[model samples]
Target chain A: MTTLRRVTLDVLKPHEPSMLAFTERVAEVESVDGVTASLIELDQEVQNVKITAEGAGLDYDAIEAAVDGLGGTIHSIDQVAYGEHVVEERRTLQDG
Target chain B: MTTLRRVTLDVLKPHEPSMLAFTERVAEVESVDGVTASLIELDQEVQNVKITAEGAGLDYDAIEAAVDGLGGTIHSIDQVAYGEHVVEERRTLQDG
Candidate 1:
């Protein structure tokens, strides 16, 4: 079977649910191995955030439901990695 | 008033329509300034992707609609930046 190894997203959300909690909630989804959230913008009413998830055989629908349950709106998908095997970050020779 | 300046997302999509066309469709939404997309993984069935959008007072709903129209499902929101001014990447002291 094909697996969704990694996914990154842009989210608009309310401040009531802390980023940590949100991240944790997403982490709880089946097949998700880890989650990371970074604050991009914050004002009085809302927060703009980036969330990245990595795992094996990720269930995209379940992840969506979790985020929606937290009152967050997903704006866009920034990146995705998927296949029968795990994903590895690619770097150029300049980095070495 | 509040503004949604930037957003990053993980998306699940079909290969048809091409990434370029999909990106252009999203860019046409009202209030969007720019968009960027990176390929995370590609298999015979689907493509997992990351999409980033930056703009002033972004209309999140409009963006969502456009993405949906393209037969894409947003998997997660990865990051966000918003406020009166533009978003600038913040670096740590170690970087300097």
Candidate 2:
């Protein structure tokens, strides 16, 4: 699977571990599945978690829904990989 | 116009404003042009930005590329609204 590097997310309510767990649960954006990625401590109050998943793993709308489902809000979502929209589509096919 | 809530991003390098600025610079993920988004303070060293835009903003692939273009890595991209893949596409349509 293609790797998508640092996709930064902010749990607007607070910097809590539960918020992190929510993202992990709903990582499958649209059709992409998820694999293990790593996280780094960027700051005391925030973390930088990375993962290699099937491109479909990130459903922008779905992700947002998942976050709201968990009672937390996101600030922004940035993908570190450039020119890789297919990565998301790839996962969709896989999920199918 | 519909507003998409928090899309959290983490700049793995550092908790610096420059990193934040980078996200804003390439805020146009792909096809989705950008409108104004807001950010909020969540913790000791984190921010929670929010915005309202046509679903046609936030290209997963493009946003990833934009981040890498800046040198900052992403942790993960979370969409606060679940079941909203159309948001990315809406932005794409707008861009087209």
What DockQ does each candidate score versus the true complex, computed on alpha carbons? 0.05, 0.03
lDDT for model 1 comes to: 0.75
Q: Give stretches of model 1 more than 4 Å off.
A: A1-96, B87-96
Query: Over the stretch B1-96, how does candidate 2's per-residue lDDT look in tens digits?
Result: 443422444334324554335544454454433322233233455544332222334455565576567565664443433243543423344442
The lDDT for every candidate, in the order shown, is 0.75, 0.42
Worst-scoring 10-residue span by lDDT in model 2 chain B: B32-41
- The recovered share of true contacts, given per candidate in order, is 0.09, 0.00
TM-score of chain A of each: 0.86, 0.42
Give the deviation of candidate 1 from the true structure as CA RMSD.
16.3
**lDDT, candidate 2, A3-95, per-residue tens:** 222244544432564434755765645544653534534566554544333452244456557656755555444333312232122111111
Best candidate, DockQ-wise? 1
The number of clashing residue pairs in model 2 is 51
**Cα-based lDDT at residue B56, candidate 2:** 38
Candidate 2 displacement at residue A71 in angstroms: 1.2
